[model samples]
Target: MDYNFLKSLHIIFVVSWFAGLFYLPRLLVYHVEAQEKDAQAREILSKQFEKMEKLLFNAIMIPAMFLTWITGLSMIYLTWWDSFGSHTWLHLKLCFVVGITIYHFVCRHLIRKFRASEFILTGGQLRLFNEIATILLVAVVFLVIAKNTFDMLMGMGGFIIFAIVIMAAVTIVKKIRSNA
Candidate 1:
């Protein structure tokens, strides 16, 4: 019932949620890449990834996201949303959370698509997609920690640049691996 307890739990679930957000996409990359193998090998690995993906979604990602919302909303309610509801920083952070929640469901859709061997996204595209979450995470974390003092415009610009760098690095790595 205490605010501090809810905050702590919220933090814990936030961490868990981000962990799943980070990893599930990576699993997708692996799953899609596995399709390049011979049919038998691809079947075996796809099945394995299917199990891992399901377990991660059901056991970790979904639950953690739910709890993160529960604990976070509890804190807001318990405090009467006094200082939070009107804050621009909180608004921006919540918008990012909303974006990622949509992203989470999109990932679920991707899982089903992949399960049925309907690969709309290539492995490299999926890698770039994963960076979207990373960029959102950076923005949300900075917003929460900086609050009113945060510079949203500057931070968002920086995140865009950071995401571009990450994608470029991934591209370089992929090229190197392919050329090797």
Candidate 2:
């Protein structure tokens, strides 16, 4: 098959993958905020998000990531051949991609609990998480673009800070929910 065709498909898929990554958390924010637990609205929201995630990965993200890596490596093999292993940008991108993938899985587990009515963050906490998610996505974009700088460190640090904030927000929200 044509390399250019694969690369084009790869780019399209990647764009779709990132689009889903961008939107899913926002949906979660809405899902978490709604007070209609075990109601029709909540169930609909859960199903919609589940469908989105499934399509995003199976129909778009996974294939795109695979194509991108394969075509990218093929291009590298055909072009650089020898020095491809030492490419720092590629390495950095790999780290970021893998980290995001791990986060995706963790989010899946959490969202399942959410769907099961076992865990639900309050509206305010959902807002906080939404903000943090936006920041994290921005940080990821910056890391991908900058590729080499104190920015990568900043991104990692941002992730840590956001993680802490999420934890604290969870604690507070749970307290609020329990009290109310």
Candidate 3:
């Protein structure tokens, strides 16, 4: 298979995986918050959200994640096998990929907990948790785009700042919504 074709497929799967990562947390936020409603409404919304979460995770997220890994690893093996250790950017990107993979499984755990009527995190906390994917996305994209030329110190600083901004925004939004 062509390297470009593998890269393209990897890109597509990354996008799909990120879409699930982005939406699944929001669904969890809704699912957690739904518990605050009246009993009947809570029951209805919980069941619906659970169904949605299951469908999204099983049908979309898992497949996309696996494909992303397969294609990404394929590209790496095909292109970078000989000099993989020399690619600092790729190393960092793989770290971020691992982070996102952990995030993905944490989400799976959350889904199981929700299914078992265990609401461990509040809506606000889940809202903050949702930002993990966004942060990882930024880090991975930046590392890939700035490969080799990327300054480690500046990149880490920028990543920290970006994360702070995102968390602050989420906190502010939560406060604003609570006030309203």
Candidate 4:
């Protein structure tokens, strides 16, 4: 298989997977917020959100994640098998990918909890939680684009700053929504 072809497939699936990762949390937030509705509305919204979450996670996210892994590993095996150790950026990117993989399963767990009517986190917290994928996406994209020239210390500092900004923005949005 051509490396470029595999790279393209990897990119496609990565985008698909990230779309799920990004949207699933928003669904969870909606699910949490739906609890504040009237009893009948809450029941209807909860069931609908659960079904949507299940369909999104199972039909889209899980498959995309698997294909992303397969295509990614295939590319690595084809191009970097011999010189893999020297690619610090690849290592960092893989670390972030692992983080994303963990995040994906954690989402599944959250769905299950929601199915059981276990709303553990507030809507605001879940809104903040959704930014985890954003952070990982930024880190992974930076590592890939920067590749061999990537600086670890600078990246970490940038991630911390970005995270603080995201948290502050979420807080402000929560405040604005409450006031509205």
Best by lDDT: 3
lDDT of 2 at 71: 69
Q: Which stretches of candidate 1 lie over 4 Å from their true place?
A: 83-85
Runs of candidate 2 with Cα error greater than 4 angstroms are 1-4, 36-58, 120-180
Q: Which ten residues in a row have the lowest lDDT in candidate 3?
A: 86-95
Please tell me which predicted candidate would have the highest TM-score against the true structure: 3
Q: Give the local distance difference test score of model 4.
A: 0.94
Better of 2 and 4 by TM-score: 4
**Candidate 3, TM-score vs. the true structure?**
0.98
Give the per-residue lDDT of model 1 (tens digit) for 1-80.
Answer: 87888899999998998898899999999999999999999999999999999999999999999999888778767774
| Clashing residue pairs for model 4 | none
True lDDT of residue 83, candidate 3: 98
- Candidate 1 colliding pairs: none
For each candidate in turn, the TM-score is 0.93, 0.58, 0.98, 0.97
Model 4 TM-score (2 dp): 0.97
Give the per-residue lDDT of model 2 (tens digit) for 26-132. 66666665546678877777677666655654665566556656765666666556876766655666666676666556556656776676655655555555454
Q: How far is each candidate from the true structure, as Cα RMSD in Å?
A: 1.5, 5.7, 0.7, 1.0
Q: Over 4 Å off in model 3, which ranges?
A: none
lDDT of 2 at 162: 74
